[model samples]
Target: MVQNWSVFVSVSSFLLLLLLSKFILRKTRQHKSLPPSPPSYPIIGHLHLIKEPVHRVLQQLSYKYGPIFALQFGSCPILVISSPTAVEECFTKYDIIFANRPHLLFFKHINYNSTTIGSAPYGPHWRNLRGFTTLEIFSPTKLNTFLSIRQEEIRSLVKNLYSYSQQSFAKVEMKSRLSELSFNIIMRMVAGKGYFGAEVEDYEESRVFRRVIGEVFALGGASNPGDFLPPLQ
Candidate 1:
């Protein structure tokens, strides 16, 4: 029993040391050609520097770090390219390599693992969707067909606002109303019914969907550490 225990302990220690050595070597190799970035905390990386309204924080960092910098967030490695030249290179010269967006927690949950157009990777699926959108949905012929519908919707919206403006102390939540109007118009065109006027039980569900879509946009608009700290994402 003593001999067996001694062998097990020796093997365990060897494996642990091997793992640690490999991890250090891998990190060194990966970062050898990467851009320079700010110092990060152990384990959490640059999570501490991340703040609400993330774009402002990123803009500040860009000012300090020369636009093209890297950082770690959680276990992810992130690269930020802020300069116009670097941005152009990313989208033009290294377009294919840099086209893939970082997979983040929120996108995974909200986009069904990037099945949607906005989140889908730059591949055949995205190409197909883009083709469909261009050829079928937004083609000149389609737009011409829908012009009357759009004009009627706009007229109704203007009439509603005019009526509201007639009140003694008129007030308008223009943003919310515009969002609803847009949603209704799009839903009508796509489904042959408006969420507001339809007798469907899912009218409320449609509102929920709109709200969730808005939240997703808001979250995406916010700064996220995972974007800068790529490996953490």
Candidate 2:
């Protein structure tokens, strides 16, 4: 009977503490102006409100909350803008302010500690990288040197399509084919060889490249739990 009474007291104390903390937090936030946010749980925040087909869910939220609203996913605060005018203002007028990439785990590890052009924050390092790519890689003179590579890849794609179509109308998956075509063209230009299609110099190396790149593309766009949840990180 004594143990049961103690357990009840402990539970009551925990609930009281939770309530007090929430009240304090609410009072603290009342001083600042934040965008309209749906009610969120303490730790997980609005994470539980999100579902698959995220774009659709966000659209529905936009209808209820208006063009601009805020969300909390774990410890991270997110600003969702559904207005084209707001998007334009962010990209054009305040581009520099929004240029920094989010510090995600994938960028930390896979992108060589966030130093790559895509992962790096906006600053001198990024400017240097951009300048180098502009002058050395994407310059007209440099692209002209790889003109034959592009032409050859396009011809190969057409020939493959023709051959496949000759034997009745077989459904060609353009998405994968186009992906391979683009990847092969880029790899050939960068490494002096393609990693996809039948023209690969090393089959094993090409297999590894395909697998690693496929995983990168798959994971790059995924909403990782570690990215938002500090405990998970």
- Give the candidate number with the greatest TM-score: 2
**How many angstroms is residue 76 displaced in model 2 relative to the true structure, after the best TM-score fit?**
1.0
Measured with C-alpha atoms, the lDDT of residue 202 in candidate 2 is: 97
Instruction: List candidate 1 stretches off by more than 4 Å.
Output: 1-23, 167-171, 196-233
Cα lDDT tens digits, model 2, 1-233, are 99999999999999968966875586358526778888887667799999989999999999999999988887677889999999999999999998999889999989999999999999999999999999999999999999999999999999989999997988888998899899988998988899889878899999999999989989897888988876588
What TM-score, computed on C-alpha atoms, does each candidate reach? 0.73, 0.87
| Candidate 2's TM-score | 0.87
What C-alpha lDDT values do all the predictions have? 0.76, 0.89
Error of 2 at 57 (Å): 0.8
Question: What C-alpha lDDT does candidate 1 achieve relative to the native structure?
Answer: 0.76
Off by over 4 Å in 2: 1-31
Candidate 1 residues 1-233, lDDT tens each? 99999999999999868866765565679777978878766556688988877889999998998879887776667888888888898889999998777676666777888867888888999899899989888999988877776776777778878887886668877886677577777877788655542334487776777677778789877767665444546
